[model samples]
Target: MRRNVRVAAYAVCVRDGRILLARWTGAGGPRRWTLPGGGMEHGEDPYGTVVREVEEETGYQVEPVALLGVESARRVIPRRGWRRSAVDHQAVRVMYEVRITGGELRSEVDGSTDLAAWHKLSSVGLLTRVPYVDTALRLWRDRPPTGRAMGSP
Candidate 1:
């Protein structure tokens, strides 16, 4: 079995009763919303990854106030409809209840996100949000330990 692991960070930026989210355009043309963050660079700290990704994707600087949780997932990728490979992505995301330190919200033209906006937390389910949103929220609500148990498979 071929395996790959990836670490990423996401920010749960809440401000004025709203949460910051990014609309992502998927390869299948579907739009999905998610928190402002992304993958970690080699040897980069998870906290730094979120801060950097938030700025890059949302044009806003955020400071990580707390670590919400970590999550992982595994899937099989089919190559040309026959050959397949198992891929595992483990994200040690340090979700922070962030406040915008600076910069205006803008879409990253040359980045993973296409649009950035603030939405009421209550209305998040009404929009097309990535699965991670729910997971992150649950973790935030529960406030799991920094090195607590692993997420469900």
Candidate 2:
């Protein structure tokens, strides 16, 4: 079986009891909320990648405070899009707790995500979110030792 590993970074920015999120519009699925970040480019620093992706997706400037955790998932996806064959995908996701230092909320143009907003943490349950959202929140709250990153590229 063909296989590929996709590594990405995400931010959990919480301030004043609200969490910052970007609305991800899928190709065939309903719009769902997700953390503000994306895949790291080749030769790109993860820190720089997170900064750029968050800005691109949410229009907000963020500073990564601490690494919340790492989440990984694997699944079989028909790889006709990248023009690759049927394959397995392993996503190693880096999660961080970030601080929103600046910028206004705006919609990302011609991107996978469109809207960016701050929702009450308590009310986040009512909104449809990607699974990683819950995982990030739990890692942020639990603060387990195993969740801490030693040093990630």
Error of 2 at 117 (Å): 0.8
Q: Which structure among the candidates has the greatest TM-score?
A: 2
Minimum summed lDDT over a 10-residue window in model 2 is located at 144-153
Report the number of backbone clashes for model 1. Answer: 0
Q: Over the stretch 31-143, how does candidate 1's per-residue lDDT look in tens digits? A: 89998888889999988899999898888988888777677755654444456655554445556667678988888996677999999989988998888888877776677
Clashing pairs in 1: none
Q: Cα miss at 18, model 2 (Å)?
A: 0.7
C-alpha TM-score for every candidate:
0.85, 0.89
lDDT of model 1 at position 13: 82
Alpha-carbon lDDT of model 2: 0.87
Off by over 4 Å in 2: 79-84, 148-153
Deviating ranges (above 4 Å) for candidate 1: 81-92, 146-153
